[model samples]
Target chain A: MTAKKIHPGAPGLLFLALFLLLSLPISLRAGEALVSGQYLSAVGQDIKMQITVAGPAPGTLIVIQNLPIGTVIDTASPAFNQYDAGKGEVKWLLTHVSPGRYIVNLRLLSPLAPGGISGEIRYKNPANGRLINLPVRP
Target chain B: MDSEKPLAGGIPMVNIDGARIRRIREEKGLTQLYVATVVGVTTDTISRWENRRYPNIKKENALKLAEALEIQLADIIDHGPPTTPPTEAPSLLSGEPSKQEAPEPQPAGQEQAIPLEATAPPTAIRANHRLASRPVVLFGAFLLLTLSCLALFWWSTANDGENQVAAVRTLPAHATPGITFPVVIEVTTTSSRSFSLILKETLPPDCIPAQGKPQFVSQASDPPILKWIGKITGEHTVYCYLAKLRPEAKMDTVHQFTGGVTVRSDDNPSIPVSGTDSLQVSPFHWADSNSDGRIDDEELLSVYETYGGIEGLHFGKKLIEEIWASKGYRFNPETRSYEILQ
Candidate 1:
């Protein structure tokens, strides 16, 4: 009996097709951005929260951080950010952000743990003025 | 030669797209001297017209220019201009001779009743290498991707040959759902002799053909293939078509256009179009002609002028009107519509 020679990469092509098919939506998608926050280990009474803004180009982002009742920010990198010590709030207004991971670090002076610290990333897409609000997560 | 008509407080002075003028001239195989001769202007003036150095010209001259180009006056108007103050005011009504053009006697009783300037000596104007180089650079980067696309079919296809045909596609920077946008394919062949050729354009799955210049030969094909059959004559040929995006197209997705120029040959037939071929769809309307997101009065007027007569196509004019009238707007993802903001 004689058998026909089959293309060895036939399965590979199928996977390639599948991979492209899966990524099609991702490739063709409009601008969708997200901001995430995670708490790093604390030293003494100082607590740190790392904020990440991930998105495409030309994004003007306004990220707001709400601290626990008694939390006061010691300092924040990118000195231009606004932090109200009395209100226990921090706001970072980022303009014309290029695509990539943008980091904003916040160090808080508080006796309380980071149990109730909350924040959100807001972006007003110029194309449609759709205010995108994504909550930061651990 | 679109002359800017000044308007009081409210509206901006009309401006012409210099880059577009240059493209039209280059695409039509018209030299600066030819246009200058017909329009009775120096090649330097013609060059300036094509370079935005003279964005506004007298309406009379514009009409002559429109006549010289064999296109309508409206076709040359810059539908979109920056909202900010114009960097430089157009050198209106100035035909001041630059050192570039030599003086020549005008022929009496020539076809047109306009003063003729010295024809550009043999070489009318130097090609704007800066504008030309960018596309070459972009095409160089995408040449690999297009070749890879060709390679997908290369296993059984004959794509091995010296590249003599080059093509560049001009697409609007942005495409909005439910609107038709123009696409131009510029094919330049090094060959002097005319030869039969097949130009195949592969549109995104969400795009359907609205109109074709010579009309596509192929009736239907999956993935929405558009083919134009014609002879490759002269050094350059331009093919154009309008593709309408589905009204419900998913936004933010990258849509790619892949195509090849297949000449009548046995060895090397297909040469893939090389350049930026992908465009993303947004909720913005195509009527936002200048692509500033919000449709304005002039842009809306242009929309009516360019696309109003087409039957069975609703370019979301009402929504555009609402957006245009409103102070601001936002796109609601849930409703898939633009809501007017106060």
Candidate 2:
């Protein structure tokens, strides 16, 4: 009768397999940040621009609207902090931004140019003061 | 004698151990024919039942066999071999304890603990039957545990294994007295299990937090401390505050920020804030992230995304734009701010 050969490392192999199973990564993603802008409509020469932000309100969040140099600025709902007409930059310094939609309304002087409105959102992640800049979407 | 595993609502059947049946039949000097005839089965079926080849049989058939053997249904029900001798009067199935509840006198053939052993191939099991004997399996398991612990220790030591949080500290190019710079630690959780973690940050001795709590887990420590307890939910959370340099902090001098994060749990995994052993105090604008004299197109665009709408910074976004439009810039020590070289 032939005898079975016992491999010495069998027990060790069994345990290594068990440990590998425990260390596999778990996948999940349930958080988000979005900055967007829309041209609602236009009156005789007054165009409307709406900016919205959906995120945390823990830190100061900055948004800027770069309009055409010749465009006239009527007013802003959540009033802008600065307006440099030479550069056509309408800036809003929104502080203590709470969770949910934060909107900034702008009444531009004329019908929007094809590429007239271009802007972005700058946020200082409070946890790690690292700055994240996201473009304001169309 | 019913197995704990759920059944499909088919006819009731049970696993017969057969060892007790054989012993009872032999003791009574009863031939297989007599027992088969009494139970109204062929001799072959009774033989199969005696050898456990037909381990599971109809519950009614089992009851008939018990009556023929002058025993109870539990007597021949398979509970995986005997641990104790049969009782004087065989009890009914109601008296039968579960396989787990019954005293187990296991032989050397199978392992009850390590589930991994069950996955071994038949040939491998035969091979490990000798090599993976109880003592060897126990030692291997212990060694595996020790090695796993050592590997985790080495990984955390090597890179701070930012496996829990990819956190970064926001430091201004330099610290200015009477002016508080931001101490921002942004942590993004990679795991979703709910638990609390305490972040302990050791600031440079030359600085103190503008305002916050539990600077120390205990007493206020020598180097001003920053302690934050966070109940982590799956979210993009940020921890930020302001800190100013001490009066003694000299111009052009740099101080490092360091700290550790401890997760409260059974394993108590503690991850040092990655790269905190030392850090460079880069002198640059929150806008000129790269510390270059110019906020080039890309950097300015990034600034717009990260800090464009952030409030409370004395520095203006227009200045960053001017810097972007300029040839370059320089830090005027007297002003403690960067200037565009128009």
Candidate 3:
């Protein structure tokens, strides 16, 4: 029988190294998840929005922040939902947003998770459903 | 395989093998009908073989079809293992080949096609397509319902049963003592409903409503005109109301209109006067010191200097030339006094 060779402190040392590396990124980015999606335009009057998260965990709360002034949330008809994590599509509807430039921030929150995601979408009108680029502030 | 062969007088079919058929169909930019008409076969047969509907097309005919369609025979005849049969064959079709039959009936070069005649009318199909795309239709209906409720609430509040009337009084300038001055009161209705007018005054037997109690003239479309002649001068309050009676019914529902005015009595005493004897006095007793007005300066200045430079000469100047103008008075140069003409 051949004797098996094993490194004495390899497993414990490897786990410690991984734990340290993971902790660094989590500390750097905390409180919110990073999200990205497309702003889809409807065939009718108002514009529609579709958002997706890259790796969304269960029980994550999402909120849209940083709306333009005088832009009211149409609570009369608010459409928002979370998609299956594997499916990768969530949709929200906003009506009578008026004609102007706006920056919509998508924020994600989790009770147990260390970090979350946030993304921005710009909405424009008149040219049917054109997606314009929005400059992000530092 | 035999059923996959093209039939005569039927729609023309493309004889290319599976691979070549797919390639040519995509390149020609023609639908399954185009290929079906080019060769003599049903579009279904073309779809079946191209999609590998049969185990295999006979080797000889497969080659003939490939040559006609100008494609390699092997590409059309896939030699790979047969696709596994679906777990459950759809219940709709019976006795059809379990694995080889088309899962959905499709045309020859077309992956999935419905005959134009069998398909829904264009208008109905378009409506259905639009309806399916709009998943927010229910939300829109709910929003309309909420708006209607709000409109109803506004309508109910606007029609609340209440009527209001307002009155304001204005007096004319420079009114004569013991004489009536025009006092105009503007009345306006501030309610959606309409009412009638009832004006009552505390008159001293002398002053009346110009007409009588329950006067109907004020209720007319235009504001009623009334003139009050002063009898006794002091403060007097006039009470008026809008006597709103239901249409075609007689009930005096008085809406009070109250106002007051101050009148000066003629019993106030006048200043007493005494005459001073002045020798070589000017014929005109009252003289204008500023010489700008008739006699306004006499009341302002107590002492007066004559234009002749005479000093220490006093004269009692009377503002009124005669006390009884109604009894007729005329100035007499000889007597140097005003006396009754009669």
**Taking the candidates one at a time, how many backbone clashes does each contain?**
7, 31, 17
- TM-scores, all models, native as reference: 0.31, 0.41, 0.15
Candidate 3 residue runs with Cα over 4 Å from true position: A1-138, B1-20, B82-342
Model 1, stretches more than 4 Å misplaced? A1-138, B1-162, B286-291, B295-342
Q: Model 3: per-residue lDDT, tens digit, B102-156?
A: 4876567775765654578988877877887586777778888899998888666
Tell me the tens digit of each residue's lDDT in model 2 across A1-138: 999997899889988977766544321111234444565643334445555655544345567777778678777778776677788877766655565566677776566756556677776554444565767544
* Alpha-carbon local distance difference test for all models: 0.64, 0.60, 0.34
| TM-score pick, better of 2 and 3 | 2
Q: What is the C-alpha lDDT profile of model 2 across B39-143, one tens digit per residue?
A: 557766776566554466667778878866768877777877433333212225434444545686888757646677688798988877877587888999999
Reference contacts preserved by each model:
0.00, 0.00, 0.00
Return the candidate ranking by lDDT, descending.
1, 2, 3
* Candidate 3 similarity to native, TM-score: 0.15
TM-score of 1: 0.31
State the local distance difference test value for candidate 3. Answer: 0.34
Q: Write the per-residue lDDT of candidate 1 for residues B179-234, one digit (tens) a residue.
A: 66777788887766665566889998888877777677664545898877677878
Better of 1 and 3 by lDDT: 1
